[model samples]
Target: MTPALPRFPHGPGSRYTARAAFSRTRPNRQVRNINLAPLVQRLTERDQWLAWMLHEHRVLTTQQIARLTFPSIRTAQRRLRILYEYALLDSFRPLVQSGSSPEHYTLGPAGAAFLAAQAGCDTAELGWRPSHTGRIAYSPALGHDLGTNELLTLLAARARTTPAQLPLWLSERSCVRRWGDLVRPDAYAHWCDDGWREMPFFLEYDTGSENVARVEAKLASYAAFTAATGTRPALLFHTRTASREAALRRRLAEPARNLDLHVATASADFTTDTPWGPWWLPLHTPTRRLPLAELASRWPELSPAYRPQASDDADSALGLPVPPLPPSDQASRP
Candidate 1:
């Protein structure tokens, strides 16, 4: 008998989900039908919040989770192991050329059910299926996704130690839902210091994988957005290295100049420097690297831009991209 091909859900044939069908090489099991109601009751607010994050971002590494939510790496590992055994989360470790990769986590069946039950919605409405973790385990964008999450997680980590706050952070899906036709940013975020002085911006995390010209061309959409909305939000680029940053600045300068787009850039040192420090170099002031706080000061007009939540939009204002930071004890309570 001719063998039948396995099917996939959520229409993952798109490039975002490069591997269309189920991975024949799933490294971890997504256990199902566990008696998790009691376990869910015992789950901490942070644990619930972590599951919510996985549902939103698709995946996160142990290091990223520890930095974002837990006080210590050991502590994170201990709790994460418990969650995995309870089927509240599923995880996988991708093969690497050198050292082993950190365990990456995604919402498991129990976690999805818990979230759906909490929200009074069906599991299908939560946008998850039995094949969810299988698909992510082999995704080509795994590294890129991790990089994007790491950057924002770092910001959230810094926010914890400082007086700054990450009030609003949106994933690429949320960005698309909000501004798909006009622009496609990898992520969207706003950073605020002690005074609550804020700057909202779109992030384009570059891996030096595509043409510089192609990256530059995205400016046109931002220009179109400004034309349509009569509001301009800052567009920031974070690339892998100094050379890539230089190439982008050169190609982007003229279009940005011609279109009057608000663009700033930071390079590899982004991870080392206090992200709030003077690492960002706005195109207008190329010679001077300004602190993020000072940069916000430079553009006094760069305030939070209101988004149009069309009735057709699926996300409730409170859902999808919750706050960049974890939900508080009060907010996480059922």
Candidate 2:
């Protein structure tokens, strides 16, 4: 919904090679026409939402789409196959070393056309190019993008069954528009349980490729952000391993304490522990890990610095990204 993750919660994984292959485009795909009425009439609300979501994220694995929007993986696959058939989506499965990866999807020509028409703007304004999917397939950052989206999509999945909701999730692009000068959070978000407490945090999804000093150095900007905004949102570091987490925690403890910043550390295993469990190790209490919701309580004054512009039940007139999950009206459908 917002610009694609400049960086989001993720870790390193398989790299797509120049020699890699992708799922072939369906031979019977429909051609785009100047008139989009027929195309618009044919799509379900879910289908249209998925297309916008793809445009926002640039690409999404089948598993991510399923968890973020559908009732089940089976239903997601069935519906996505139809979208591909009509050229509403374009997909490719990476040629991995062992077992195959879930197919990855990017916004297709028809989808791009539909969204542009809806916004009453040009596709170029949407930042889409004819070679969108092709570029994504060959980019070195493919693994990192998928990994970052994976973290939030998993959180979206868990929130699906519970009362919790993600009120605002700003992509790296949106983060830059708002906080670029002061901080470099890969993404910024507000997680809340309906009518209760909200936890706003700057997400730093690490791949463990940098030196500890490089990681520690980023804290200075976070310190600057706090001083400027008069709001103290938590800064979370999601890295790749226990060892990486340990090294970061040790190095960050002093700087974080000195700045009086609230920093927490976790790793790849967090997805397995389901993010809500006791996986987060705050720099202040490195010895004990606590659940995520508990972190909100640590700062009784925790409120998002800026409220999201979109209402819970309606789209923005100026086109803000929709909720991370689909509309509640579509939540129960197959």
Candidate 3:
């Protein structure tokens, strides 16, 4: 959290107008609890556009903010200019990146005040509602498929067995907050155990393996997370290649020991039981594409010991067959 800016004291003659509002308490250095979901739901596209502007707070490039939000780079740039002219966003430009001209935009003080007020609310009632471009909004539907309630349920369930705390990655600012810029995780999670165990997990959602640079960068990021959190989190990768997985872990292990991670594949050296059932499971399945809602409905039937004949193939439905690991790696990795 950044230090609170100085506030002017109320003068004896100062009087509030109908449109003006005043804060009763001084701003705390710590983040005051607020319901972000309702705040986000109260916003519209215009609000998002404006909020994105404030994210940089007068220092981000237009191109950068666009890339962060819109579908395409060109579209992001175009819309950004429009927002600026309409007084919704502020921009400054002709800067350099690797020696090229670029435009930067950010939220003005007016925008900042607006967001701060919204941020000040009851923590218990507020929740995170993420936007389509992956920003936290204030609404019931924080993100697309996984609404706020659904997320709470799934997170609560994961909390039961996973021995690590679950920290949220609501924004880049959050990364800066917990770990500082020099050392921070992709997301922060501190297990809410008796001792309040804190572990920062590195999350990588891979769609395909084309971006070598990105993968390498994330590995470096994990290094930072480990240094800041004082413990290595379970490296969680959604879907990735065996070779890629091995190489990344190998690189990560050099810097940090006591590392524990989970990568789901069709075959592995370990057979673990889950809420789903007890069986040797692949990280990725070949055919079980059941939607999560359907899975929730039929969750009663699935136990650690339960396995369906349909899931008989060790390579169930993740597209690849479970390949037997060579005796060496299997024994090493759990």
Clashes in model 1: which pairs? none
Q: Write the per-residue lDDT of candidate 2 for residues 197-313, one digit (tens) a residue.
A: 778888898887678899899999988988898988888899877888888888999999999888888898664638666788888965678777678877676656556643722
lDDT of every model, 2 decimals: 0.74, 0.74, 0.33
Stretches off by above 4 angstroms in model 1 are 1-36, 306-320, 328-334
lDDT of 1 by residue, 67-102 (tens): 777779999999988887767788766654356567
Report the lDDT of model 1 for residue 164.
Answer: 76
The residue pairs that clash in candidate 2, if any, are 9-148
**Which is superior by TM-score, 2 or 3?**
2
Name the regions of candidate 3 deviating beyond 4 angstroms. Answer: 1-46, 49-78, 86-88, 97-99, 120-169, 175-183, 186-251, 254-257, 261-334
- The TM-scores of all predictions, comma-separated, are 0.83, 0.86, 0.31
Q: For every candidate structure, what is the RMSD over all alpha carbons to the true structure, in angstroms?
A: 6.3, 5.3, 20.4
lDDT of 3: 0.33
Error of 1 at 105 (Å): 1.0
lDDT ranking of the models: 1, 2, 3
- TM-score between candidate 2 and the true structure: 0.86
